[model samples]
Target: MPLIVLCGLPGSGKSRRAEELREALSAESGGERRVFLVAEVAAGEGGGGGRAALRAEAERLLSRRDVVIVDAGNELKSFRYELYCLSKHTGTPHCLLLCPGGAPRPDRPPLEAPDSRNRWDWPLFTAPEDPSEPLPLPEIRAALFERRPPPPNQSTRSQPLQAAGFLHQLDRLTQDMVAALMAAQRNGVGPGQVIPLAVEGLGQEPPGLLLSRAVSLAELSRLRRQFLSYAKMHPGEGEENLPQLGSMFVQYLNSNLL
Candidate 1:
């Protein structure tokens, strides 16, 4: 499954755009998939903590399905990156659907003071301000909400091994597969082409009949290595990279797992 994170500031129409995306995806896919719209309010007792809480909630929600749309005011680069990482760590494809608004300060009101007593949620402290622009609220909102076909090379359905329990399953499965591949390699098989043999033993069939697609043994090995590398290199990065890496791993598994 792939996760789409809608990023914008308050009054950026993220909610409306998210709904439109959900409807379009469902209609195109025969209305068989589940799309989650996770929303959050930043006005609670804990101001900036709401963002962290939203990230946690998004992570937990990801375990439930393949297509999740996070509706939030993601104005910070760090936050967007975190969403990407979460998708990668969970083995789900992740994309940033950004809504660039023209408001001087999309996240905050133009006339508001830093210490203003407005009870509404304040925009991110780091949001950029551009004074020369006229807000493109309608244009951006229309573009964001309009229904469109899936991007080139994107899968129509969620990939397998993306569930909450996938990590444990993959850990055990990868150990066995590696062991089998190593055994084969020891018997004179090339190390550069070991994933096909491993794929033969995966219990679950690859999603969208990916296994049936034409693929070379060398390509399979490369993909396998990519997956391993993503898992190993991800922890060193910030939380934002997790979803991106997780999604990439899931795509690899979905395309190679037999």
Candidate 2:
């Protein structure tokens, strides 16, 4: 069984997808292989860089199960590499599911780079003057407000727009993922691979837009109609836009077997 790692930003629906993967894998196993899910937060690990406990739990789960799913915002290159190392040490096949997380909203401030925040085991995006120090707010503000900072190598450079920046983050994340997975595969991890799965509208609505308290039935109907109209306009993009977790797992297994 392959150790599947769910990587995405916050509110990216990784948890739900992880649960889906766990259930799907369990069903496919038919009581023969145990499926375990280890969440980074629930592991009670203290803070960023405190993944030892989480890693230990994953190792233990792997020992008892045929599949282990790691649910976390593995946005940093280093963290993904660490998982690769863990798979190598434990002798388990590893595959990464990279969720593009949802679309960005224009109203909110751009999300700080995952590395900019020290909340998780992510590598920091630091200034060139001091690699350990985060880029100053002035630099970040210049990038975000001025709409451009500098070139790629410039530590202060940011994406042209928030959406562009998020996409860029995904690009960098996927690149690192491929590098790590390739290394793992070379070292004998079974089909160490990366899959891009997008779950649309994970956290698009704000509290005011939620259905329970404020939203009326008429408003909901309008939203539904709007969605239907949009879908009709792009009929070819049907449900095929993103494969379900179960279908993806099945495809992975089948490909490996072949």
- Estimated TM-score per prediction? 0.41, 0.39
- Point to the candidate with the largest TM-score: 1
CA lDDT for candidate 2: 0.44
**Clashes (N, CA, C under 3 Å) per candidate:** 23, 0
Give the runs in model 1 whose Cα sits over 4 Å from its true position. 42-46, 102-258
lDDT by residue for model 2 (189-228), tens = 4433332222231123211111112223443344333223
lDDT of each: 0.47, 0.44
Residue 125 lDDT, candidate 2, scale 0-100: 24
Cα lDDT tens digits, model 1, 125-206, are 2122343333333343343334232233213234343432344444444445445544555565542343343243243442
Name the regions of candidate 2 deviating beyond 4 angstroms: 102-258
